[model samples]
Target: MILLQVQNVERLFGSDVLFERVNLDVQENSRIALVGRNGVGKSTLIKMIVGLQSPDNGQITKNKNMTIGYLAQDNGLNSSNSIYAEMLTVFNDLKKMEIKMHELENEIATFDHLTQSQTKYDTLLSSYDQLTHNFKEANGYGYESEIRAVLHGFRFYEEDFSTIIGTLSGGQKTRLALAKLLLEKNDLLILDEPTNHLDIETLSWLEGYLQSYSGALLIISHDRYFLDKISKEVYELTSSGTDHYQGNYSFYIQEKAKRFQQKMKQYEKQQEEIEKLEDFVARNIVRASTTKRAQSRRKQLEKINRLERPTDGQQEPHFQFTAERQSGNIVLSVANAFIGHDDKPISGPINIDLRKHQMMAIVGSNGIGKSTLLKSILNKIPLISGEYSFGTNVDTGYYDQELKNLHANKTVLNELWDDHPTTPEKDIRSILGSFLFSGDDVKKVVHNLSGGEKARLLLTKLAFNHDNFLIFDEPTNHLDIDSKEVLEEALLNYNGTVLFISHDRYFINKVATSVLEISKNGSQLYLGDYDYYVDKKEEQLLLAQEENKQTGEIVSKQPEKNSYQLTKEQQRQERKLRREVEDIENQLEQLNAKEEEIQNQMTLPEVYSNLQKSTELQESLKKTQDKISDLEDSWEEKSMELEKFD
Candidate 1:
């Protein structure tokens, strides 16, 4: 079942073609990623598929029964309802069924007392039973649980559920909108930049949730790690046309390289043959004996389908970081620092010993002061407590996530040239060109540049600084995937140390030699990349759980008890807990099986038509479900206790 098909799609702006000959098919349960450089019209293509816009040259086909959920980059929930109420709107149909079932139950009860009309009584009972069955089949009984689970995944808590939609921030509203869309469970989910406001923890949760999703997903995101996890195939839109890759983002990279090499080889071979034929024709056309043969060869040349020269897709910015001088072994040191603003500490008592050539990534949940800590070190904000220092002769360059250092009124050329007054205008233009600003682009004011352009301009300044140490806050924020790769490569090759804060797990994994996990209380250092930090964090959590378990055991025991007796008692307790866990698990499984069997039996024609038999089965299913619920509770308690011993 193809949920959506885009055939020979083309979009044009005036006389200029944006893209042409685009074709893609989204089958049932497809996981796809749409990737391209900035300004490549990926969002425009999504609009065409969702019927928000029409293609200029071709058609988009969708199944008549198919429903689409589209979340644009800037869209948010618009409602006067509370947060939880807004989410509940997605289940209005189920709610209506529930209300009708209640009404039916009351009416059936009233009719049960009237023995004067037996046929009407039987009819009421049958309708009530049918409605009950439909309610259960529609998951009317458990829709609230589903809502709660999704709300929690999006970082919305029970206490915040009652907050009015109008009171929420724009980002929070956007997140809620996404939560509502996920609850809708449409046939196809088309998301443009779904990873926009998510931190790494939430991103991980979203990845896990989408992995088991039952419908098709079409995502446009610059988060490469996310694309690798959520996408099964990739469609890369380019100015010339669209290219399809049959794998995840990682595979797409490798496969794209292989294809590019093959194309280049074919093009080179064809060019060599063309050159030889043209030379032969030019030399022999004037000679009478070979003129006929030359004419025949010329016709053959005209028939040839000339291959276009292979290119590296769109022109991406080139980045290179070269240090003018090397600093001492110790590049930066922070001692027991408290970082925040307005004489208050939001996070810290932080410590860092950044050494030369070590790219350390600072990571934490959003709003944990990761960026503030960097600002504190850079003297942009006052440190509430403690101190930091740079090593001997170490110069630092900073890349602010907000681009606060850029002057709004300055032209792109002046922004760089002002910093290097001695540099010639031509030389400054050359540097700006490498960063993808050329001619009229150089004259654009800093205030008018897009986020990507501003980011590129900032990088241009940083690259020119030639400092021994660099500190960045969310350097990958506005960069496309291609530009991020370029920045990563530049940093990896630079002979300097870096300490940066990033929510991009992929960027951190690529560039960081160490990871600093920060919290409101303090910070801890892991001597490896992002992946290593996660593994070590998990290990630490397990150790803490085990230690807490041991402490509980010690506190429960009497001091007078002998060691051997305590050990024997502990072992016996563990065995008893394990047995209880296993027993509860088995009982729950049996009860679930019985409940399913009853539901299945009720669906049969012979049983549903017979009121008494259907009623009996429903009663049995209710009992089985109640028993399953109790056993599930017991299973969870016993399992937790058993885990403590392990």
Candidate 2:
């Protein structure tokens, strides 16, 4: 069923048209992604759909019975209730039913011993039974468990369930809002930039959760990987119109390119035919012998419908990072480094050896001090302990996510030209032009520039410096997908070494050659992308679980059964349970071995060097790990069951 339909929807801001002729449908359980550049009015469209705003033209129709849940970007829950209590609001109806069931039980018990009329007694009994049935059907019994599961998925634990909403951080509150929305289970969920504050682990969990979600999703996100995982269809919104792609982000990229090429071919073919007709008319129209033929050609030309030249949607910034000079093999080395503020360490005894030409990414959970570490390395903050050294002849450039390096009072052109006063004005303007700052745009004050414009200005400075090494703190924070791709390409082609901090898993996977994970315990290095890091982490966890089993450290928590003789039937049941548990353990052991085999294959030089082979092995490894996980879960359950026979 179509829960919502947007037909030729158009919106305008004064005389300027934001977008026109927009069309889309949200059917039951559909996963739709609305995507475009920064100012293409995606949020405005969402508002119009949700009835927060009205369209200037066309119409939006929504099913009267359907419920819509909208979570705007960074829109946190505002409440005085505890986290668990707030989640319970979604189940108020179930709670009422449960209370009625309890009341019915009490009343029905009264009739158990009373000399009541038969019809009245039967009626009370039936009412009790109905209430009980309704409560059970609504999951009143397991609602708390469901809440716990969702809270855990969002990284909220049992202890944090009682935490006051007002006391939580903004990010935490936003996550809680999303969790609450999920529990509501509305017919349609409209989320805007929902991936903003999530780390890679949380993002992965969210992807899995939404994959099995029962409701439709209309999502706006800049996370390409998230879109690819969640969106079954993508709607590319532009100023002129919206284009629908019947696939994920990757497929959209491929298909969109193919379509643009096809359109170009068609347009060119029509232009050629028009040119021939015009030439025939021009050459013969003045000739007396061919006047009638020329008149017919003119009619054909007049009736032809011309094709507009095709264009790529938006202009993406160009980026190229060139090294000024060669640096030593070891670009940077840090050991026993404690990075944080005012002599208080957030995470440390960090150690890293960044080699030349390696793009190493720093990743950690929120507030774990990834950016602090970057600042410490750059000497913007004093390190509490240890030291870091730069390689010989290394010059560094930095991109601050906060844009703090830019002077607010300076104009865009002056921002770059002032740093290099010796350069000609036109030459400086040319560089700014490459970054999409031209003419009057170059005169905009630094403080007045949008986030993306500031990011480009910073990159422009970085490129101009021709630094041999670069340190970036969340450089992709303000960039659109197209600009991010450009930056990735620049970094991939650059001769300089890079050390950066990012929460963008897709960007990390594309540009990072090494991943340095920061944690409370310490720092660890993984020799691959984000996916490889995840694979390695899971493999280690499985190995640890296996070792614990072998060491007899996973003993049942239950006390031994009271000493007593068992009947023959009881003995048979005990035997069956033990056999199943033993079978699960054996299967787990085999899977563990297979997982190790795949890991060993992944380490082979030839396999690691080949992207396709490496990807295949990773996929195989993931499948094996998933099986082991399932077997482990089964093993735990069966072992607990066998404990009853102990």
Number of clashing pairs per prediction, in order: 0, 0
Locate the minimum summed-lDDT window of 10 residues in model 2. Answer: 556-565
Please write out the lDDT profile of model 2 over residues 1-646, one tens digit for every residue: 9999999989888999989999999999999999998899999999999999999998999999999999999999999999999999999999888888878777877765456788887888888888778888878898988888788778887678898999998999899999999999899999999998898767876886786688999999989888877887889999987999777677678768988999999999999999999999999999999989999999998998888899965787886999989999989999999888887889889999999999999998888988888888889898889999998989999989899999999999999998999999999998888888888999899999998899999999999999999999999888988899899999999999999998888899999999999987669999999878866766665566567779979633212221122432444455456546655655665577679989999999999999999999999999999999998888898778767755
Cα lDDT for residue 379, model 1?
A: 89
Estimate candidate 1's alpha-carbon lDDT, on a 0 to 1 scale. 0.86
30-119 per-residue lDDT for model 1 (tens digits):
999999888889999998888889999988888999999999996888899999999999999988988888888888766645455888
List TM-score per model, in order. 0.84, 0.84
State how far residue 612 of model 2 sits from its true place (Å).
35
Which residue pairs overlap in candidate 1's backbone? Answer: none
Candidate 1 stretches with Cα past 4 Å from truth are 113-116, 286-291, 549-646
